[model samples]
Target: MDSMQNAPSTEDTQRTSQPAPVLALLPETGVSYIRHAWQDMLSGMKLARLGATLGWLDIKLRYRGSILGPFWLTASTAVMVAAMGVLYAYLMNMDVHKYLPFLTFSLVLWGFASGTLQDGCTTFTSASGLIHSARMPYSLHVLRATVRNLLTVAHNIPVVVVVFLWFAVVPAWSWTMPAACALWVFDSFMATFLLGILGTRFRDVPPIVASTLQILFFVTPILWAPELMKTGQDWLLLDPFFPLMEILRTPFTGDIVNAAIWPAALGWSAVLTVVTFALFARMRARLAYWV
Candidate 1:
């Protein structure tokens, strides 16, 4: 009775003057969770530091046991680039130096782009150990595979350095590289966000994506030059791989990228990202059962 009588206290009366917590009634937590599960998709989403760090760890772990550890990645990349560069570059009648950077960057970018999808098909199922037992975010699993591939790219970096040195051509020298890398990083995460959700649903998706990326590896200017094709100016600018890599290559080679690629590359990345996020948002609730 005494406590009830004192319920309306002087301190409480003073606190009542403060503002209440802001909650958007239209956007509830459930909707937010779904949104959070897939955010960076459509056009422009913030780069996820968490996703990137997780990718780096995956790389360290993948090559942890060797005497050279990750250097093995360096060595292996060198050999593949050299061998392929010699045979393919010669046949195309292009100078080895001119062709080398293109190939190295091609393979490395492919590593980043393909890494996410290749592993994503198994993102949920592979993490069955964690999926069922642990309560970690699903993004962490995607991080594992993407990071592992990034390590592959990291290993490939020195090869790029050596190629530039050997060719003695500063294909790109100034601000372009950072911009390209920035673009690559963003697109990579976008790829991860969407692929992570899709990978969980379709068991056969991984192999299918792997095979497709293999075909694209040949067609997408990795082993060959886009200019080598008969397709005209529009195709070169519009090639699926060119815009993405040119962003990187221009910076590396110090060439100005066509103004059109700015929107074309980023626009597609954004569109794909948004579509993936929307699908994931709609379907995330069912992931547990599907996995």
Candidate 2:
């Protein structure tokens, strides 16, 4: 009886030892999120090779039983370009030679960019099983998705070559080709990381994004050239995706890339990188639990 009376109460112990359980779910501060983002970036760089291999493996498995394998993507793209080139050129009253090359490059590059972003929305959640079982950098998943689509893009380049040769079109080499591609990668990575995190939590974002992309495909200058709309040049510039697309497409088509595109694309990449990193950092700790 005396020992029981002298013992500290369970309520007292619980009250003194911990904060309220609800407080645990509260969002982290800005500084903490920034720190998490920085660590993820460093960790991701350290594991880039692993990500690349995984990405390659993914490509191989994706076409494991197929005869043509990855080339199937190229063939499919070629057929679509052929059909669209004929139909759209007639509708728009543009020269077939001019329209075909422009359409070919636009569609190919768009596939790379759009595919990366769409797959990115599933980055973490799709790999939730592995993420839960293993201890590795989460950013590696984003890298793998990006690299996988990049390989797919590389495989599709032959189609572009065939188009160029058939039409006797010689595309000029520009310094902006590599520059724009580099910036685009940065934009793609951040988008994947950001959307992946949100997707895991919301569960609705993926479908929403898919729907948005479908709508965007029609509105984006994929089927029609921006130069075709001279009165709406300013409106075309307002299309956030066009500037990014044009950087690569212009260089490939031997057109002078707009000077404004460089700064615009760079600025877009920088902003997204910063914002996505911070969001990733803030949510990094909760991913495993949420998934």
Q: What lDDT does the true structure give each of the candidates?
A: 0.70, 0.85
Alpha-carbon shift of residue 93 in model 2 (angstroms): 0.4
Regions of candidate 1 where Cα sits further than 4 Å from its true position: 1-57, 236-239
Candidate 1, poorest ten consecutive residues by summed lDDT: 39-48
lDDT of 1 by residue, 89-141 (tens): 88999977778877887776776677656766666676677677856666566
In the range 70-114, model 2's lDDT, one tens digit per residue, is: 999998999999998999999999999998999998888888878
Residue 33's C-alpha lDDT in candidate 2? 75
Clashing pairs in model 2?
none
What C-alpha lDDT, on a 0 to 100 scale, does residue 154 get in candidate 1?
Answer: 78
For all candidates, what are the clash counts?
13, 0
Taking all chains together, the TM-score of candidate 1 against the true structure is 0.77
